[model samples]
Target: MNHPPLAGHPADTGLELCEGSALQERGLAVSFDIQLWDHPARAFALRFDGRPVAYVNRCAHVPAEMDWQPDHFLDDSGEWIMCAIHGAIYDPRDGRCAGGPCPGGKLIEVKVDERDGKVYWYPSADVQPAFPD
Candidate 1:
């Protein structure tokens, strides 16, 4: 019943709902500065991979958002995550930019963790590099 608070969640503030469950998590969004992508950039964070790994959520070429919806990020193939804004395909396994204008570009990996049954996104860094330090 005791855990740290998700005070720095990028999406919103204080216990944001992710994949909803009865569990209570403790963490925050890394991109807490901006609610939405300004120019369809890549950003990865709020991961369930033990710690958190987030990116800009953008494609290097067009520099667009991978998801069509606000937070609805995923690829048409589903096997790989795609950028909805510019059709950039990437490997969800590592957030690596696979196909699209920026062939060499990669998907920014989001960092996160699940203490109980809730998911939390890491806060954006002071600078830019995709994942946190």
Candidate 2:
């Protein structure tokens, strides 16, 4: 697969994820694609108490995507992030496993920032933006 060039260098620049209002309108959760360890990976962002939070899309219990549907991460009450596959609940603020099968396990966190009307997620040494094949 061909991937697009990363928005910016992970060390210096932040990748623009989405508009702040758009996330807010969508109950504060949205999905985006990135490169993790040189492989295609999915991630999601959420707003917890008006703050932006993000995590790798994979579940800690089992290395599987957690969203119930495309970009859907929150439960009905929109209070916690739930894994659609195993009923695992996670704390949106810190990606901690609040209650679920993956005890003492937490979702991988991706650094994110919401500023100037847009949301930006940062890549670390292990995670980077995916490029076209």
lDDT of 2 at 30: 81
Candidate 2's C-alpha runs over 4 A off are: 1-8, 25-28
TM-score of 2: 0.87
TM-score, candidate number 1: 0.52
Clash counts per candidate, in order, are: 51, 6
Tens digits of lDDT, candidate 1, 27-127: 23233322232222344444333444455656666755555665445544445556666677766557777777667776554455545555565443322
lDDT of 1: 0.47
Q: List candidate 1 segments past 4 Å from native.
A: 1-54, 124-133
lDDT values, one for every candidate? 0.47, 0.82
Reference-based TM-score of each model:
0.52, 0.87
Top model number, TM-score: 2
